[model samples]
Target: MTVQHEPDNWRKSSRSQNGSACVEVGSFGDGAAIRDTKDRAAGYFTADRDQWSAFVAAIKGGRFDA
Candidate 1:
């Protein structure tokens, strides 16, 4: 399997508030990266373009809503 690298320009989620559960995202050449805003030193995870798209779609479709 191919490995993905973290992106350079990470930005906090727009829906994030002044809370400890916030996250940040960054876009790489062919994918995206996600990291914890509260523990940046913990590093991050990356998803390829297709995976990222699917995740976003699921979110929009409320697949993750409580």
Candidate 2:
């Protein structure tokens, strides 16, 4: 699937400091857009609303804990 990059407003996480390493996120219709703050022109990852929600929940639940 081709992911279209939108001009929607992108915001970095508040935890981002010095604008060095960070991720930017924005809403694209019923989905979400995520891109590296350091390389906005490269590419981004998009996920449906439900998928995004589940991913966020997993993160909060430490499903990726190692």
Candidate 3:
């Protein structure tokens, strides 16, 4: 998925204790953008609302554990 416009309100994950290994999330009208906190210039990936919801659900369900 691609974001049609630049996302706003970029913020890092609350779980980020140290700055080394973290990601930042930004919000657009239709979806969200995620990028490496250590490398903002590397760009970001976007996901539509549904895809983002599913991804979050999977994470909460431990689908990505390990």
| Best by the TM-score measure | 3
In TM-score terms, candidate 1 sits at 0.81
For residues 1-66, what per-residue lDDT tens digits would candidate 3 score against the true structure?
943777768988676797567888889677789998778899999898999999999999999999
As a whole number from 0 to 100, the lDDT of residue 54 in candidate 2 is 99
User: Which whole-number lDDT from 0 to 100 does residue 4 have in model 2?
Assistant: 61
lDDT by residue for model 1 over 5-37, one digit each (tens)?
567798886767778788888987688888897
Candidate 3, residue 62: the lDDT equals 100
Off by over 4 Å in 1: 1-6
Q: Per-model C-alpha lDDT, please? A: 0.85, 0.84, 0.85
Structural similarity to truth (TM-score) of each candidate: 0.81, 0.80, 0.84
RMSD of each: 2.7, 3.0, 2.9
Report the CA-based lDDT of candidate 2 relative to the real structure: 0.84
Those runs of model 2 whose alpha carbons end farther than 4 Å from true positions after fitting are: 1-5
